[model samples]
Target: MPGFPRRLTSRAAAGLALLPALTILLVAHLGSTSWTIWISLTSSRMLPNSNFVGLRQYETLLNNDRWLVSAQNLAVFGTLMVVGSLLVGLLLAIAIDQRLRVENTLRSIFLYPFSMSFVVTGLAWQWMLNPTHGIQKLVRGWGFETFQFDWIVRQETVIYTLVFAGIWHAAGLVMAIMLAGLRGIDEEIWKASRVDGIPAWRTYVSIVIPMLGASFATAGILLSASVVRLYDLAVAMTNGGPGLASEVPAKFVMDHLFERGNLGLAAAAATSMLVTVVSIAAPLLYARSRARTAETRR
Candidate 1:
């Protein structure tokens, strides 16, 4: 072959080497997603079948009380998890960065929860939050007769319990993110702020936080994704609770997909979730892109 044709062949071989990863991505992710979209438009029963029914499944999904509640619960849970984790994680990181002793041990203690599967951790949290046997019992044993940490058992407050466990499980990851961001800052910044007579708290609030915007954004996105897919924790903790109080979208999808034998409805719910995620994520991505373009221009 001529030189140009040989060069083309070499480039084609390099591209072919990526085929395995591309195939996995398409098959495992995009393929399944496309199938789900197709199935959502059909009247599939326990297993998917080829009976097209247009938007009936979506209409039914829209009218579903459980699905509606799950959406609301996800909104509340997502907000709490993302904001609470960020604040608590930033505080933990700041405190640990204060030249304290045993910092590594403390960091490990905080981070170890992130390493464990939420299945076990969620169950452990459930046990700890159990009304008759856990915190209430232990505290009551200490002679406080009216201590009520029984929110976990209440329909109105069970979602908050999920938030608590979620924060516990996820804040460590946030802490690690923020801590890494903090460490990357120049030591001169801290010294200059100190020399300028700025209080450490003000310095952190005004100067450090702005500098750590990328870190906060990263942690927030991670937490938001976790919140969207918050099934395992809810299942292990409340099992959709005292009359569907803690129902979330992922659990709703799973229930319909398996137990209810309504793949169409499940697919509709999944599509709704995807839409919601895109709706929320699109603006953030657009803003980030614009910011990058402006920075590059500057």
Candidate 2:
């Protein structure tokens, strides 16, 4: 009984400290999500209402050509962006892990882009990819008249350009994460691999990569979240132009909500995105948790 008052006081203080976060989670996040889901099922347009249309908006969304194009573009962008960023970042991390003389400088330079906003990255890439004054023009000026690098203005290739920008912006963050993971590996592992006549590349591919599962998962989740909310870069770079070639789900939702005044459609799109993210994330999270539990037991 003597320690009960102190324990009670400590518990009360901890709960009190968590009150604001709990309020925000319940009201700001869960409440907003519930309301959005409700609105998506309605016939509301330009404003919220109690119309209760029952999945009509989602049906329309599926049938819409622009929405379909946007969805397809998102798949392309997300796949290429995530893969490219991971590959490029891993290579960079591996290079730096070799104890180069300019490791710090290289890291700062690589990470500098990630520090800049996506808006800035988009604008920079846009300028660099512009046909009139960008790479094509510059190359033409260098006597390469027939060299064409104008992917941004072409419908089929505009999404790829966005992927390039996304990778450039995200690769550094992934590199940093992987570098930390690499540094955490035991020196004995490297020595053992060398003693067993394993090539350095083989060691990295077989042993080191498997050991950096946590780092890879962390970077992947972050990249996937960015993919789901990919709006600013698309807006700043192409503005979903080139005949909606670069349009993504988030941009489509925004255009419907604000520009088109279609609240129901916007909410439906947003809900679909949420569901997709949750579905992908749920399995990964469950597997990770189970792995951790198994490790603890072992």
Candidate 3:
């Protein structure tokens, strides 16, 4: 009976400790979501209005070119960012997992970018990618006379610059995740593969990679969320410049909300982004849940 009381006390204390976090999530997330939905239905502009405009905001949001461009940009940017980051990160992880001579130093160098703020990363890249004073200039000064790598200032290529930065920043994070996954893998499998005269690459492609399904999922989901909420990086790097070339959903919503003073439209844009992200993420989340359940049963 005395031990039971102690256990109860510990449980109670743990619940109390979590109370604040739960409260914040409920109030901040749920409450804001409700408010956004309500605003989207109204004719709010410059300030909140309860004009009850029905689906007028949604209609306008769907029809707007800026929103459409933002959506398209998101597709390209999100895809490239996720895929490139995964590939680079996986490669880095594999390389480091090889028990290199400078393991710790190399790992820290790779991971250094992930620890920096996106704004900082974007700003740094922006300078480096600038034509007159950055990469191009540096290259030209080295006697090439016409070496140009100014993707940041080009309408057709500005979004790709974002992708480049996104991959560079996120690859380290993916590497960390993959490294953990690789490390957890049973060494016996590697020995067995080698004994069977299987190539290392083939072993990774067929066996080890499949085992790291969870790592891939985690990296993808993380990158997906970052892609959706990709405001700070765009702001710092390109400011959605080159005539709406690198515009993304988050930036579109923010521009409408603050600059254009169209609260209802902004809410609609925000809600649309939320729906798109949920549509993409729900299946992934469900699959991951099912896999976890199967793992537990096994």
lDDT of each: 0.93, 0.95, 0.94
Compared with the true structure, what per-residue lDDT tens digits does model 1 show for residues 1-298? 4699989989999889999999999998999999999999999989899799999999999899998999999989988889999999999999998979899999999999999888888899999999899999999999998998999989999999999999999999999999999999999999999999999999999999899999999999899888888999999988998798999999999999989999999998999899889998999999999999999999
lDDT of 2 by residue, 1-298 (tens): 7999999999999999999999999999999999999999999999899999898999999999999999999999999999999999999999999999999999999998999999999999999999999999999999999999989999989999999999999999999999999999999999999999999999999999999988998999899889988999999999999988889999999999999999999999999988988998899899999999999999
Better candidate number, 1 or 3, judged by lDDT: 3
lDDT of 2: 0.95
Clashing pairs in 3: none
**lDDT tens string, model 3, 1-298?**
6699899999999999999999989899998998999999999999998999899999999899989999999999999999999999999999999999999998999999999999999999999999989989998999999787988999999999999999999999999999999999999999999999999999999999999988998898899889889999999999999888988999999998999999999999999888887897789779888988998999
Which candidate gets the maximum TM-score versus the true structure? Answer: 2
Off by over 4 Å in 2: none
Clash count for each candidate, listed in order shown: 0, 0, 0
Q: How close is candidate 1 to the true structure, as a TM-score?
A: 0.94
